[model samples]
Target: MTKFIVKDIVDKFGYDVLAGKDGINRAVKIYGINRPGLELAGFDFEKNNINRRVILLSNKEQLFVNTLSEKVKKERYEYILNENIPMIILTEKFTDKILLEIAEKHSCPVVRASNITTSRLYQLVLEFFDEHFAPATEEHASLINVFGKGILLRGKSGIGKSEMTLELIKKNHLFVGDDRIIIKQRNNRLYGQSHEMLKNLIEVRGLGILDLSKIYGLQVLLDETKIDLVIELIHLDDEQYKSIDRLGIEYKYIKILDTKVPIITVPVTYGRNVSELVETAVSKLKLDEAGISCLKILQERFEEYSK
Candidate 1:
């Protein structure tokens, strides 16, 4: 992955360059917004990961800097800048003259984010870095939203994933992607979307390619969704289906970009309403969440009758 740098943040946020033009390209390793409360009180910079974060001297830090001895301020400033951190951001209401002098001397970029409070700026900058460093991948699947649950349909070619998607949309579910899905994992959760070219479009055997937005209206389309469950379709005969676990008491999770997503295998047979099965499966999941499982209830009833 390309390193996110100080200049990138400067250009992106339109912040003023108060000092340190030379080191504006310094790389950022983490998304932490460091206020340096500990370092201000004479804590050692060498002992912590200051270089990994973009130092922000907010209004509080700036006011606190005035009370510090000139020796303490100068020594701490030099120590922090020497780490070669990405940048130092000053919020709207704050600036430290001594810190800027040391920062300029060491070539550590000092940016001024105007018109935003320290708390708001911290939240904004954290989100920016978190999103920038998010892990992403591509998967071959048809993603849809059924009963407000994001469902990913996967199988071999000609296994009716697209056909099932069509039927699901007709039943008022939302379509996300067909064939190629761009899966991004952020903050330990996976979000899936279609490529711009493939958005709201699906190819059927007899219908070639169809724009779902045109046929079913734009209300039936979604650009992306959080992947809640994956339903894998398999062409299983009755004998093969009977051998597998009939009760879904335990769910198996498949790792997608460092996130484990629950996966369930469904047998697809000729003349079966695969889309209805998919919807019913999601409904069962909802019931399971509500502490009502038909299979578990059946087991209890059978045990009671035997007793």
Candidate 2:
């Protein structure tokens, strides 16, 4: 339900507004961009529900339209204008005076970007829409990338989340964010990043704040990553530990911005190497992704032995 104005795109991309300045406030309801190729070739816009999409006129599409007869071109323009599209973008220095006139007549905004190619323009607009329309939330935790997998560490303050992340950093894992992690859901996946002011800064008890990138080198940090796992560290008494499941066969998931990320609960007990345990957990997740589940295999063997 997110809406953006044609003026927003014009301001953000610095596009030249060729005509339809009065329609700058036109609402763009959908994040999709259309080429208008099929529509130019007699496709029905109403049937396809393309009236809400922002139209882009690339070089090839423009050239193809130029080959059509004048009557067909006029009809195409009339059909498009009547549909009341959000806006039209001409990519890579290609411009049609006739199309601009039609847009002006119907008060449809037409913009031109001459610097980038059509594909690059498409990519930029896609990224803009993805970031603008994505569902996002924030978490008070630390995120790190280990072996190309993003792992989020969450727990109460003083539960050693930062300290454990420090250990992972020493083991050559990459740090993403500390204290506050911004998580956004795009295409059913969760991605995490640090706040602008807190990036690369980690706080340790009694040690003050430390710049992790400075100490461990720039290669030991990632600006953002797709969150693949969530680990929660809990300080449990002996009785509490005894009441928990020992088999570790249950699946736990934490919801972040409409995406469910697998979560593991680890007891923060003395003499336990939480960092190593997390590392091993990530490796096990990789194995699970590859369809090699150690827990399932052990359960199968146990079933056979019991029989």
Candidate 3:
């Protein structure tokens, strides 16, 4: 997303100024395929100058125009060189000599876009921006980051995943992914996504669909979150799998992109206050990392009592 002044475009492309000096120095942004910010492909009018019309040099947005006659192509090229178009974006490869001549003569910036399909290129570009612009740390699972960690609430969809997130939001925690988290791994970092179908909206079994942004006043919902933990809710019962309050075992790993992430499981039952339990689990994990294990502490205290 490098910013280019109109003069920069002209000076680089080798196009002759056929018209307005008003736009000559006006600023524009050029996205080249090889650049970090311009990794996407597509014909975008979204950010175009209100007064300037972008002239796409490629035929049908294709990188190469094989359908046109060589003579016609040359004529088009000459026409472009002589026109006062704001900027010219090149897709097809041209010899450096010709390109240099055009640049030297016209002073128009020569930018080469990737050869991918316009739609795909645009998608890639958008995705890149989205990932690059995401926040550094996310505190909640409802929002997903581009790293592909789907922190989902896996307890029957109604066990207050969204509600708990709303509470977490009140605690000033950033939201990342929600109800339907779409996880994808890019460069080994786990990113999470809110399914487009459920974006900014949460479904509470008996309560139906709720707009988190509206109810929470726009501070609650986030576009995505980087998932490092999975908080699973379980109904407490006389089941064999009930977790004990002991330092017993540690580090439950949830598999995503073949990577194992630490998992924290919390049990829920009537009148037990599940959300508070989850918050405690999160806090305990943090303490565990700092070498303060609650279970281990309890065990040591018990052994001292026995002594």
Q: Which candidate is the best by lDDT?
A: 2
Worst 10 residues of 3 by lDDT: 34-43
TM-score, one value per model = 0.76, 0.73, 0.52
Off by over 4 Å in 1: 1-29, 37-51, 68-79, 82-84, 97-120, 195-201, 209-217, 237-243, 300-307
Cα lDDT tens digits for candidate 3, 1-307: 2344656544544544433444466454322332211112323333333433334344343334354555554444454443333454444532223433444456544445546554554455445534433332322345422122334455544566767666666666655556666666655666676766767776656778877677766665567565667766656663524555445367778776765677766676667766566556666666776898777778899999999
Question: For model 2, how does the per-residue alpha-carbon lDDT over 1-307 read when each residue is reduced to its tens digit?
Answer: 3467889899999999998888999987787898888888877646546447898988788788879887888888877775458899998656668888888988899998877978889999988888777888889999999989999999889889999999999999999999999888888999999987899999999999999878888998899999999988888863445655666676578788777889888889888999999989898889988988787899899999999
Candidate 3 ranges with C-alpha deviation above 4 Å? 1-97, 100-151, 238-240, 243-248, 296-307
Which ten-residue region of model 1 has the weakest summed lDDT?
44-53
Please say which candidate is ahead in lDDT: 2 or 3.
2
CA lDDT scores, all candidates in order: 0.84, 0.86, 0.53
TM-score (C-alpha, index-matched) for candidate 2: 0.73
Candidate 1 matches the true fold with a TM-score of: 0.76
lDDT of 1 at 95: 64
Off by over 4 Å in 2: 1-30, 35-52, 58-87, 91-95, 101-124, 238-243, 296-307
